[model samples]
Target: MTFTFKKAVRSESKLRLALEGISGSGKTYSALRLAKGLGGKIAVVDTERGSASLYSGLPGIPEFDVLELTDSFSPEVYVDAIHAAEEAGYNVIILDSITPEWSGKNGCLELADLYSKGNSLAGWKKVTPLHRKFLDTIVNSKCHIIATMRSKAAVSMVDGKVKKVQDKTEQRDGTEFEFTVVLSIDRDSHNAVASKDRTGLFKDPEVLTEETGKKLLSWLSGAATISPEIQAEAEKAAQLGVESIKNFMASLKESKPDQHALFSDAEKKRLYVVARKADINATQQGK
Candidate 1:
């Protein structure tokens, strides 16, 4: 076999965003808001009961589907959920609280413990493959993946004075490294900081919202340039006729694929619905 080399090209890839925060840190609400910004059909792999659905009716929050994984947090279960979401045509899959799958009840750690009995070194062998599979699924999935992790305060006795310490996620050590962006949220303030970002999208702490999600998308798509005139016309056409809107989207994709990322799947869906209504009304009038 001969070794080959080629010029590096930009990879228009999906995102893997990890949000870590302690309980009451608004990680669930924030993640849903971000997912709304991601566009297309959004699905949540819910583990904390039905908590993901509670914010459904909030303003700016789009309606989304959910799959509850309350039975077990096994690694295989996570793999299954990723496949199911991909098969269902969801553009974004929010794995809310991946923490449980790693360390919570019935998770990988438990399985390792059961198999190893007392041998610490042997325990990892049982769990490593399971973790690798799940991680591979998250990294290689076609859809955008956002995972939330539960965090706990890291406390240590310093000079005999107990003080609140830095937050640590319940996931395996170095789990944050797998994600394209790692956001650490303050439990009380609800502020988020991009502790790690491959895209250089979020440099400082900010409140995570739909807009934040949009900004990240823009960066991911190379911040494509679209003239003001074309954008205005596209918006007008989208409002007036369904066929025109479809044509407009098609033209954008062909001419400026980068700018096409500007429109979210949710926005496109809403416009399509309006266009369909107009067509129906027009047909009735003609008849």
Candidate 2:
């Protein structure tokens, strides 16, 4: 194998964001605002029992579709909801509190227990594939995705003084890595910090709003009106780690009729190169 270097070119990409905080940290509200700025029909996979809808009809927020995942927080349900949103042609889908899909009722934790039979480490093996499927759904989905996660926080007495501190996400470990950006918030102050950012667009802790979404869109879009289908295809191929570029090329050739018409020959080739690079990097890291 040989390496080839070429001048870097910019390509549009979808936003994969995770907003995590303790209760009252404004995750849902902020997510809605950001989704609005991304600009397309928006949908919310509300897992917080209608909490997200509370902000609906608010003064400045735009109208969006909401699919409430009540009762069970199953991973399969979350996956299906995302797929349905994409099929419905929504531009952005917010998974409010993906944490429960991991640790809540019938979630990954239960699935792991069913397979593990007592050994926690062995249980992970059973649950990992399911979790990976959900992550892949997020990475490969056709629309921008913003997920919220609940964080554990509590007060403790240190030297007879009370203070609050951050704790782990209610979801399982390593879930945060699935997102391109992860924003953590202070529960009381309602300020956010970009704990993880691949784009380097955000700065220190601050409030996130529609303007934040606008800023994100500025970088995500350029003169090129990158079609949503192309973005979806690139993200999926990159994250799936498909080994054969030839097979990927075949898939692109057979894209949906509309997408096929929209993507020019040069654009197809560019997207393939990008997907190939992403797959190669994913393969290397997995090794």
**Which one is best on TM-score?**
1
Per-prediction tally of clashes: 0, 0
Candidate 1: which pairs clash?
Answer: none
Report the C-alpha lDDT of model 1 over 1-287, residue by residue, as the tens digit: 99999864334678899998877888889998888777899989999999999988988788899998877999999999999999999999999989889987779889889878799669889888899899999999999999999888766676797744447679899888889999988765688887898876565567787766766677666673346877787778767789989998899778865566555445667778877888888889899
Q: Which prediction has the highest lDDT against the true structure?
A: 1
**Per-residue alpha-carbon lDDT of candidate 2 for residues 1-287, written as tens digits (9 for 90 to 100):** 99999765434478889999888888998898878767899999988889988998997687998998877887788889999999999999999989888888879988788778779889888778888889999988878999999988878776797767568888877887888889998876777888898766555566776756765665565423436766675556644544544455457546532233233344556666766677778779889
TM-score attained by model 1: 0.73
Error of 1 at 145 (Å): 0.6
For model 2, the run of ten residues with the poorest summed lDDT: 256-265
Candidate 2 collision pairs = none
